[model samples]
Target: MSAHAINDRRHGQTTLAHFFFAFVRGPCKLLSSGAWGERCRLAKFGGECIHSDFHICEDAGRMGNHVASELPKSCDVENLWLCERASVVMAKFSVLLFLREQWTVLVVTGTNVGLGFEAAVHLAKLKPKRLLLTTRDEAKCKQAKQDVEQCSVTNNIEAWPLELGSFDSVRKFADRIESEGFPINAFIANASIATFTYAKTQDGWETTLQVNYLSTALLSILMLPHLIKSTTASDTARLVIVASDAHFRANKLKGVANWPSILGKLNDEEYCTASVMKNRYELSKLLQVMFVREPASRLPNPTPVSVTSINPGFCHSRLTRSVESNLVMKLMVHVGKALLARTTEMGSRALMHPAVEPSERDRHGRYMSCVEVAEESDYALSEEGKEISRRLWEETIEILAKIDPRVNQIISQHLLAR
Candidate 1:
């Protein structure tokens, strides 16, 4: 584009922004409450009256370092600084944020260890605008940051504290990201836990389900707006869930036989007993695959983001070490390692392959195994399973919204009916 055209475009955007802010501020012109019991007489003079204290105009007024010693007679002005009142100092720090150039913000959860750590190291080499590496422990994250920085000096890696075991922690992390207003260039939901003892998070859900599926889904929804806006017409943003082919291995779920209505019962102690320990992990992955399908289906053609699940193919990670207490299971895992386990670096490639490269738009919801677009289980595609997936998505949204109100806002803002 020519410089003239570029200038024209910026001018048009600025004009439209001014008109938009004017429309918004028009109805917000109300009486500003004075000190304590006192009130402005602007309303008494038949001037515009705004009852709300959290006016965007007022917030925008405090934009620069410039200050005004007294109130301006009218809101109209060439510069916002000209209308400042009572030595108001515009907040320079906050205003500077708007002036900074946009950058790609990629998030990799559980980055303090294993596959997540390797992926963060790989992403760091790309020199992303900001790489948010998340782990439950602060000390581990501090170490993880040092390790990732070793890959590249200018890696804008920030270790964010996230504890998937607690609902409040997950909500807090998601809220902090939203408040920062970073565009989600890519979000990798890589945190998951496998437990043989059938533990539960503070939210009361089964530990495996909460860490692998529930919290990941909640974070995905919370980040949807940022993801959508960052996505371009030609190349959309990426949403990757580290799912496994173990999903197909899940069999004869007890309470889940009732499905949607009994979804909450998966956390029941009896339901998650030793007999079903490994099966619960498989079920969580299956639920994740189902989740991948629902959101892609809900989106319009040539979707703005890809929601994908991948199988790293029995990778050599500590995920399976949870069953070490069972001698037989431990022996199987030990033998399976030598026979088929991919190195963590190789497994990390499975995530990076789909993430960094562009694929056909129709591939948005597809399952991937070993860097190839592969088929999900028949049950995941069957009519009955589709119904279960839909119900699960709705139920998941309801559960997440109850945890944090922001989930609702993010979903409605980014997702439109096909």
Candidate 2:
């Protein structure tokens, strides 16, 4: 059978969808059906072929007829078919993936720490036009910038100080980035506080809530303009929040109504006495997921900003060691860590994948674990949860409004800008 005859037969028997599936699954079937002759005819004419041989032929033709003649012998027809199909699929997907857009900048928080540091290092390899690495500690940010620069000379990475626990700090950081006049392509809310003590931040909010949830929400709102400015009709930017699986564990302790209040008082005691800190940490992580999903459902405008939450799996980090230090605690931590823990590099892989990989661009507003998008808790997406995140957003504005009306104004201005 000639290639044309085979295509006509297949076209008569199959739908376009089936053809696409077959094309992707096994283009060799197309080759075996004798599509190569039709492709060759197409190549001979002014038209083009969809197989890899066509591309090789075209490249060779660019050199000369002599080169073109040699290509048929030099290139394997089967491999060319596969490559052609792969290229076509990628090109079509890029229409939805936003891979061709330039000027997408990634803002990474807490870039100094274990997973954050590792993510920054890996993301640098992807060569985003600009990367903003923010942290509360200036020294740490500088070190992280140095490390990332060392790893890849191609990425334009810079450092800025951002203390998520304080509304003041978040505003200043956002202002600085906006002043730079760069649109944010992605934002990773990776900074978190896992203190055992029920401390209040300078802003007079619970330390856990302020740092892990409220501040990140505020920062996102403040940076919304920059994100929007960067997005095209064809492009959708992303916000990836690094949450944890611990939220599920904390939700299980729901029946103990007064447990949070009681634990708040005991937070200052030694590690042996402040076991409840584990629950506090878990609660904050839960809130982070809630904030992402809640806004995703209710945001008036799809906002061109896709919000995603990811659990990077367990990793052996300073944060993990901080909570489990004693012999028994260490033993349990060791077992869990060994079984579930990924290296900082592996843990950050999911994050970097979401941030830079074109494949994940369409998977917006989803919760992910180990690169697979997973379902979040029902409460996190419930109306009540949406209201909770809304209340947190409003209260955060009110608090910032009181501290510096200018800061609140700037944040509001940015959110509503453009």
Candidate 3:
């Protein structure tokens, strides 16, 4: 969906391969053969390439941009659309093939619209035993269920109410799932918000902190027992937390380390100013990247659960609607989306890759982008960041334990068990 055709032959850049990198701007794999030839070599993703008529093929690892085939010399920007379409179709077909034989139950959060709704529709095509969708609004939840039902062949789709702002609501939803006693094969935490306005949830924490980080951690921790219980010899349950590329921008947290508590400092009102609010959403996602790293280390080796985070790659979504009141921010989002944004449907495919793709050990605790394992921010991989992540994890568990006694019990029974 982020495809663009660059045809400035006057600039000495006229090859189809050059246009390929301009189209996706990320890692891609060669999908099929084209009229140009059967010997198309893949270039290293994000690497400098010397294009030469698409004749020379070089072998890189299983990570790069995927092209169906080379374009003919006579073709120009008009044929680039075919290459884009082939890339999307191939991605869909690849994921669907892995999911065809699966019959597991899946739970996707934040499914009222955008990435969540689109992911639910694709997951339903797997004919899972049950597909559960969660939304903050009941009417919208019902409408989403109907929409996904119409697109999918399965009739077992059900919509549920979940508000990430309230710990009580999160508890009730988890309790209902526990009562149902259904084995969950995957739980996709896709619901999140971004705003320049500063507000707190009914539970007393900052709105973005509670909805995006605290409550998300709470729900996923609560669901661990169910996820682990559902794992089998050949199949493992997956926990996919929808994080973001914005986390790379959260490099201003140096002062917070000197504070008594990390989460405490983040929740303080003084830190919620206009300039700070601009980066708060990115900070919350940074915490999520840590969440993926820390607790995953606690789980035993060869564990049956796969915990991973993903960046949906800046889709044209309703996530920015809350910040539209600020004219400056509104203009920025308008320009950003126009320049670099994928459609909601294409963005959802990245979300679906982790939910259904077959992998157990190597994929665990990894950050995926463009449907492949990607490097985290430089800070997130540093020693200081790891230390901060450790403290944040400790504080998060302690707070969540107070909210629900089951937090500690689940950690002991599921995570700590040897």
Residue 337 lDDT in candidate 3? 82
On lDDT, the candidate that comes out on top is 3
Residues 77-124, candidate 3: write the lDDT tens digits. Answer: 233233333222211123533453455789999998998998888788
lDDT of 1 by residue, 1-418 (tens): 2111111232222122322222222222222221111122222111333231222233443633332223344532223322233122322222222222125677899988788987787677655678899989889889999998986565578998998888888888877887898788688888888766777767888888888888888888877777787887656788888887667665534445465454576767876667777578888888999998878787766788888887665567888777777899889888877765656765675666556554636458888765456666656766767777888888898888899898777667667653
Q: What are the Cα lDDT values of the candidates?
A: 0.66, 0.59, 0.74
Model 1 off-target regions past 4 Å? Answer: 1-103, 254-260
Per-prediction tally of clashes: 3, 0, 7
Better of 1 and 2 by lDDT: 1
Candidate 2, poorest ten consecutive residues by summed lDDT = 32-41
**TM-score: model 2 vs. ground truth:** 0.67
lDDT of 2 by residue, 302-410 (tens): 4567778887766767676555656776788788666545466646666765665443454676777555566555445556555555654455556556654564655
The residue ranges of model 2 lying beyond 4 angstroms of the native Cα positions read 1-102, 252-276, 300-302, 325-327, 359-362, 378-418
Please, what's the RMSD in Å of model 2?
13.4
Q: Which prediction has more favorable TM-score, 1 or 2?
A: 1
- Indicate which candidate wins on TM-score: 3
Sorting all predicted structures by TM-score, with the top scorer first, yields 3, 1, 2
